[model samples]
Target: MEIPQANLGRGINLGNALEAPQEGEWGIVIQEYFFDKIKDVGFKAVRIPIRWSAHTETHFPYTINESFFQRVDDVINQALAGNLNVIINIHHFDELTEDPLQHEDKLYQIWRQITERYSGFPDQLIFELLNEPHEALTSDLWNQFIINLLEIIREANPERSVIIGPVQWNSISGLDSLALPQDQNLIVTFHFYSPFQFTHQGAEWVEGSDSWLGTTWEGTESEMSAITNDLDKAVRWAARNEIPLFMGEFGAYYKADYESRIRWTRFLAREAEKRDISWAYWEFGAGFGIYDIENDEWDMGLLNALIPHVLVFDKDASPQSQSR
Candidate 1:
């Protein structure tokens, strides 16, 4: 059967917000202007990483907090109002990752509530089962979990598009181990941070990352080939499986050299587009931010790389100043 492609062209992840234990805990509150800005800047979609496990009951039934649902609803509505596609998923469920056997039921109930809540939403909304399944959750177990979760979601939303990815933090090599049911509505996703030493240099949570701080991507033939080769693996897998692919996340941390970041970002964006794959840059207004919230302006160099045709100007300059 042929599966239709999801048109998630030039998207950005609303990371470090709801995925954090709290909304503002990571210094992002998902303001209305954020969605408006991205929409105006040419982003067609927004992938929201939500930590539902943090807000649900630890026991059976696993009721989610009503207030939290409203908070998420508001964020989704804001994006929809701006005519942007939205993708929400289970994120940062550390307990489940550490002990999948013990928390299996909890994970099921979490998706049960999420699917029921959003079943009535428009088709513009997408559900990504979980983000970066790893740790104690082996490939076999993760594959089983996908089957179980899809059954639950199907009860409420039979045809809604849902995204699933391979284990090992959604690595490209992990694609060979991924097994999926014969569902045309499913899209395969993978994250790219190849040459992690360069992408994650100085990232606080990554231990020993400080030592990689000065690393840079110069877009040399070898460097470019490395990325192209990695992405090609995904392209081949999707072709064989007859599934559409989405590069769910890819970006360099702010600690990297500014010019190196732009070159890397532009190169990857173009490569993914060339392969007919859609992508969402790892984040917005945080460690890998392209927008500067403090100054209410964009990092135009990085932004232009992601969306090459957007009009660029010095936000600080007045019309008269430019004319003079």
Candidate 2:
């Protein structure tokens, strides 16, 4: 059961779009060209965040809406068609995370349906069991739930690469408490947003985020050391445990200063690459995105920061082939 990590190369998330309580509710409407544009810009994979709980019933056999499933399937097909690996996960499942005891069965049932639907898809399609497990879903409880859910997923699709993260909002520090299953097809993931005040500044959803709006990441030695130390622990843990690592999410909010955002984004991305850790930027076409959907253009600064080797210029006729 080899980990399908190689396929999850440089990537970005389709956030605030389909994952919105309602598709496009967050102002990003996914068009057919979005996938092509992402691949054209050098992204090798796309993480499709989805709010499956919002679309399902709160009862036995909690079936996901068929229409919604089709829509997701279509987007996934488009991504795969563009030659990019796809990661589809249950995101914003707040209810389950709030009370895993009460909703564990429901979670298992939901995965049963999700796994069955994409069970036949190619190996490039990875299933992230849940996103950012937090709140009452403590590491201990999350461990049990992950074990249970992995059992369900394995029953239907053995050998499929499944992504799991630590509890505490998938904090890197929490990785120490994450328990791995016997399955070798697992990829342990963590989100990097150290100096949360700087990364999440001005994010409306985070409490007290507004107060940190003026903060900036200077990439000082202390800052670099702090980040390196944290990531080093994760790296060492991965090596000691013999599990592959993935930096599933990391980004500075749009409200932050542009230079600070680029600095942090580039440094974090480069650091993750240095560790051979596969990663996907927090999002695309919304806050923390490299592309502005409304303008239908890439933020050249952020794009360059994420993939410094790929050069897109006004005079370069072949954007993909042009590299620094």
Candidate 3:
């Protein structure tokens, strides 16, 4: 089972859509054109965050709704049709995070069904067992849970590449505590929103974020060093463990100053590439998006910061050649 390490390069998250309580509840319905747009703009992959828990039954078997599965299948098909690698994951299972003991079996059942359903999908399609395990789902519990989920996945899709991240919302610091099985197809992921005050400023979900509004990352010596130092931790860990790393998410929120967003986004993207760490921007069309759905245009500043003109993905080339 070879990992699609190249496919993980230069990606963006399809956030605030399927991960919401409903597909459009958070305002993005994932139109087919979105895939074309993403691919055209030089992104090699898209990490789709889905809340499978919201669509499954609570009891034994925990069957996922057939229509919901079909909808997800359609999204994957669209992405593949455009030749973009797709990474789908179980996301925002808040109940599970709050009470893993009570919801553990439910999460397994969800993945069991997902893996079996997509068992025959193309290699470009990847599975991410879970997203950002935190709260009651501590590191020890998450490590064990990952083992259980991978067993379920391997039963149906033995050679498929799967992405797994550490706990504490996939924090880089959590990497030291993570434990993984000896599986060649696994890719470890972590999220970055360092200097959280700057990145998450004015995000309504965070307490006291209002006061953090106007916070900025100016690419100053201290700020740049902070990011470099934090990312180096993940780099060192991956080198020692011999596991490929993916910065599954990183971006400044919409309310952040425009120049700061560009500076931070470009700096991080380049740094990750320099370290050979593949990354996906925090989102596509919400608070932290590179694409503007309303204007039907890209936030070119951020877009250029991420892919850059010189590094645009060559759609006509072989997959291997497309690696950054």
List clash counts for every candidate, in order.
0, 0, 0
Model 3 worst lDDT run, 10 consecutive residues: 315-324
Best by TM-score: 1
lDDT of 2 by residue, 59-138 (tens): 98999999999998899999999989899899998888778889888889889999999889999899999999998999
Off by over 4 Å in 3: 1-7, 310-324
Given candidate 3, what's the lDDT at residue 226? 92
**lDDT of each candidate versus the true structure:** 0.90, 0.86, 0.88
At residue 304, candidate 3 shows an lDDT of 82
Model 2, residue 289: C-alpha shift (Å)? 1.1
**Top-lDDT structure, candidate number:** 1
Candidates sorted by TM-score, best first:
1, 2, 3
Residues 1-324, candidate 1, lDDT per residue (tens digit)? 223366878899999999999899999888998998899879999999999999997789999999999999999999999999899999999998999999999999999998999999998899999899998999999999999999999999999999998899999999999999988699889999978999999999999999999999999999999999998888888888988989999999999999999999999999999888999998899999988888887787888889986763555543211110
Estimated TM-score per prediction?
Answer: 0.95, 0.94, 0.93
Across 168-245, the per-residue lDDT of candidate 3 in tens digits comes to 899999999999998989899999998899999999999999999888888899999999999888888888888888
